[model samples]
Target chain A: MNEPILQVNDLHYYYNDNQAALNGISVSIYPGERIAVIGSNGAGKSTFFLNINGVLSPEHGEIFYHGTKITKKSLPELRKNIGIVFQDADNQIIASSVKAEISFGPMNLKLPREEVSRRVNMAMEYMNITEYGDRPPHYLSGGEKKRVAIADIIAMEPDVIIFDEPTAALDPLNAVMLEEVLEKLSAEQKTLLISTHDVDFAYRWAERVLVFCDGQIIADGTPLSVFQNDEVVKKASLTRPVMLDVYEELVRNGLLADAGVYPRDMREFRELIGK
Target chain B: MSHEHTARSHTGRHHHHKGGHRHDTGGSSIDFYACHSRIRHWNPGFRVGFSIILLLFCILANHPAVSCVIILTAAWITVGMGGLSFRRYFSVLTIPITFILLGSAAVAVDFSRQPIGDFHLYLFWGYLYLTYESLLNTLFLILKVFGAVSAMFIMTLSTPSHELFSVLRKARCPSLIVELMHMIYRYIFILMEVQRNMRISAESRLGFGDFKTSCYSFGQIASNLFIIALKKANAYYDAMEARCYDGTFAFLEEEHQANPKHLIAAGIYLTALMSFWLAIR
Candidate 1:
């Protein structure tokens, strides 16, 4: 197997209140992987992301990017390659104008002015926010702000992008748009890790699933294998995706012949049902 | 809305003192108008410099006639050239005008046990008096204040905060100060929305039914907002760190070419104001 792009081992982080945000987490994130992290609120998904990105140093354990262990001296380099799209777009956006906000990351990289401007324009185009380039981001709708927030990091051209609840405040249409963007990002071979409560979206979008519960990884595998484990799902307080429930019920009641592998999404389900 | 516009939050801790230019505390209305202003494409540096110079001219030429011209011309430039409606122009002026009236009252009205000036009124407690010279002085002060403020309004109501910050950047202002202004400007709206939502929820629960309850709710909201602001600041730092921020900020300024016509118009206006000031004196 190709080397993992990011590796976290025995990571433990504690909040100021002495609450264990991440007890002990060890994970290998390969390049070009679409991973969904699903858990209840306060399951330490955000803390885990922050730790890996070096925003919050873990009390124990180490993180490695491209086989080089992250340390104080290497933090800047690590952060340059790992971008976290925070859940609150308002908190993430630090610039007044959308164009300037997008330029922030690239500028911080000390890139040439022409390179920064090119990345800013490209990121704005990628997020379909070229028209809002000059508009104040505060006036934008929640979803539009989310796109600009994503563009802020996209301009940095990070190798790995972690979105913490990207669809929380997005409308249905905007949520679909986010998914399309995720598809495009994944196609470009950028590693993507999304933490979401939407089990259906995770089932459809992520090839690999990581179940986080109380700061520990309860399960990690393909979405089909992870969701099929009743023990882990029940422990993590996760619900089965609606489509999977229907498929399982049909097979249990002998309405359809059991297939060795369940379909991953609607298109596959339709093919199985001969629609 | 008025309260939110004027209410200072913890984020205002940054010392953002621009020379003679009062930081806009009038909420999003001015910003919205400025963002959509027809003349928003004009160079912000020229706008800032022109307004500051005009403001100084108004102050030094403290004559009422000169002030009147400043007020009328500024109103014309803001409303006519900037495309802001006359109604909005006056609506935004209302806050400063209120301050002017209250301030002028101190200088215009006085109490005495007996009449001692050109204008006097007998009252049960005392005789109110207004000397002719004092009245004229009060009038001069009011007009001077109004003219200075209106000149500032032309700049603020026509240029968005981003442009103003960029102008500051170009004027050799420290990047740290400009970056702080950028962060503060962006978060002000967020904090205001949070405050507005909390107030609405408080009102729905009869939190403002009485003076006592209103005070209590206000305290609760203020404290909660402080806590939220601190949390937000920490999260914002995390976000900035993720972007590889290394104690330096490089803001992207929109390129706007300086138009000589604007300079010529400014020159003609200032020259006319100076001649008017000389003649009126």
Candidate 2:
């Protein structure tokens, strides 16, 4: 296939005096891949994202983005290629107005004023938040704020978008909206990497799953395969999606012949039951 | 309710000093300080106009009668229309009212000249004079102070802090100041929690042994708290950078349009204020 867009080789990281947070992890992500990194708290999921984005330097590893080593000298270019959406919308939001916030990233790249305005308009329209253009960040609802946060990065038009727990505090409806946004981004040929504990979100949105445990990549494969392994799930402190759990329970009770009968959506679930 | 209002009046003044302008009472256990969240439903332009009027009234009206009228009207509006109870209103008013009383007393004692023939009471080396002009001036000053204060109270009570920020943004307030206000608003609670935790830890360790020991321990605690706060601030900044923030806040909602009704009301208020000023002149 084509060269990987991002390659991590034997990455190691730590905090507070050599207490390893990421231990010799290696992963390569191809272009336009929707990947989910699942792990419990303190499992180094956040640290890995930090390293990839060049926010934190790794202890003994090389990270390559577009064939260039991710170093301080190359950070500006690396950051331009990869956009990160933080978990806390409050902390990430820095502009006084929505329009300004969305325009900030592109403006920082020294894009022409007209280009910056066009990108801001397009990003806001894509996110369905055109009306909030003049409103202050503080007045937004939690979901709206999250959308703004995403829109901020989207305006930059990065090659890869990394979200750290995008759905952590979002309600079900907002979470679904965010998932749709992610799907759209992936469809647009932008690689999407999300670090989350949201099993259902990962199951539905991720094409490939990377399971992290105690700062190590314990499992990496398709979501279905990674999630099916009981040991990996247990080690990562994650639960299977509700449907998977139900299907497994049904098979255990001899209600179904096999556990491989997975439904992709609610409609499929209903169809599988002939409802 | 009156007692609560009185308490609020007192605490409100103290809060002004404490830099607690953005009263976030949703998760706060302090019932008296609970800000009304319903104000979010009001038309943004109307709220902005109302805020401007309140600010003007506070700055311009100095007479006690006008101030009394302002305070009473605000109280009535908050209680009758805003669905706020007298208790809630009083809780906000208590501290300010105390300050007004204290201020009036001080003015009377320090500045008012005693009428030669009319002495109210004689004390050791002092005579208490009761002058009609002095009393009227003192009362008027007290009323004006309360009036101005109550105007601010009504604005805060009727408008949520977030909405205020939105209005400020729309008004084209300095972006840096607005962002700083927002950050300070959010971090104040975090700092309070940190301070509270630090105090508890210090207490648990029995750091308050004696005068000198307590002072030294307090200094150490303060230093440690500052360092911790700085570290958290740095982490928060890193988190922001990781999220691709390049400075600028975005909102989810559209620009709030000014309502015709609010516009009309604002016009009327402005006309009335000008007329009142003319009458005073």
Candidate 3:
């Protein structure tokens, strides 16, 4: 409805030495939409993100940013608009220190030093990493590194930020911290795309879900509807979120005879059970 | 426990080089010490300069008495002025001490073709002996090496590697060498962690249940690490490209000007070290 901030049409990509990583997948993303790209390993979710972000150009199809088809000339604009927060913070962080690391993205935009400094300060403050500004980012904890990685992109002020498995290998506390940052980012009205296997996190956090299986997008809809599609979940080799499963079971057993709609999380489930 | 310090990873690549200054034991990193050092804010160029002058002074002076003063004063500055913990300081010296002792032993013991000197202790009919001259030379060499190491200890104990790298970058070291040092310093910690994790993963799978199995697992892990390194290098390049990396890495450096007080301290240290050297010579 908001002119599809980003769109991909029959997008196809392949590894140089391997088969197609993304095949015949298409989707449109809108502003303020929290999208969770869910699938098994090698499900083309990462390839899809890279394609839309212009890191990997599609061979068979095309990606559009703000209604303009992405190409070699439009790539820089597309990349600046659609930032990808890589899964491994160590890989994403190019600068040695946190301050320099955050400044990198903004400086690449070739903004004036004062504006770059402004953005750097704002990003560090936003990510709550001001204390570590002088510290080396490689020395930051997994969660701290993740924050700095996100901060690296946020400093650029991208409209659409994509995270590739933001919580993988992070400890429980760090994972929760990541969720809070995601919540804050979402609240700020920036479009967020995250590719992860954590169905529970997707169920609770994402409004929209896109399921990829074997390089093809099998389902795309609200998390409740898409995850509730047992066939899609089965094909994707993903278990349906427990909350959705329980809600469906209740409706099937006629125990939720008075139920109005499916619940997305524990709090919503409790409210539904109470009703 | 960073002693209420933030739970920093300290496993970063720079930490490997910073910890190199003080630890060959895989012990706790000395970066905490370096970051909190009294001279932490001192210009790295100044610290390096002071340490170099002190080290050369010791080596060129070559007097046991001057070496003693250099060693004692460096230890004092590192511990007192630099705030390096006694525990870490002692641990860091172990490697240097080992090498110096081995070298000194060679100097102390001799196999002569002629009759032994008057000060020599006869062994195997004077063919093998320890002479006073050799012993003196050994002691002097020991002191010289120890004093030189202690000078380095002070510098490494005070300045973190990244800052030192910056100083080197500013001094117009070949960019490629500096970058190589920076990258190698980082990947060492990352690779070491990867190696450690793979070992743990292997153990978890009982891949190392027996000596035969352990050897097999070691072989597998080494090969797997190589593959992982290749994959990681590829991923890192893509990430860098995603961030619009040009050829050079630009940083938002906080300026650190040289301190005159620090300069005065350097002057005083030179005066003290050389005064002892002059008095001894």
lDDT of 2 by residue, B149-215 (tens): 7767656666644556767877899978877876776565456556655766787888777888789
DockQ of all models, two decimals each: 0.55, 0.18, 0.39
lDDT of 3 by residue, B1-281 (tens): 12112233443423454553332234335655566578677788988888889899889998998888888889998887776666668767886899899978977887776766645455665566677788888988999999999998778878866777788888899888887776776676567667766887899999989999999999999999999999988888778767776666665655689989989988987888777778768
State the lDDT of candidate 3 residue by residue for A1-275, as single tens digits: 56988888998888864788987988888889999999999888888887887777788897888888887987889878778899878787766668877888887787888899999999989888899887755456677888899899999999999999998977898788888889999999999999998999999899999999989989999888887688997899998888877877888889887455778788888877776
Docking class of 1: medium
Ranking by lDDT: 1, 3, 2
Query: What TM-score against the true fold does each predicted structure earn?
Result: 0.91, 0.66, 0.87
Better of 2 and 3 by DockQ: 3
What RMSD, rounded to one decimal, does every model reach?
A: 5.6, 8.0, 4.4
For model 1 chain A, give the 10-residue run with minimal summed lDDT.
A134-143
Q: Which structure among the candidates has the greatest DockQ?
A: 1
- Segments in model 2 whose C-alpha atoms lie over 4 Å from true places: A94-145, A228-266, A269-275, B1-98, B110-119, B122-125, B139-179, B189-232, B243-281
- The collision pairs in model 3 are B13-B186
TM-score, model 3, chain B versus true chain B: 0.85
**Per-residue lDDT of model 1, residues B51-88, tens digit only:** 99989999988789888988998999999999987776
What is the C-alpha local distance difference test score of candidate 1? Answer: 0.88
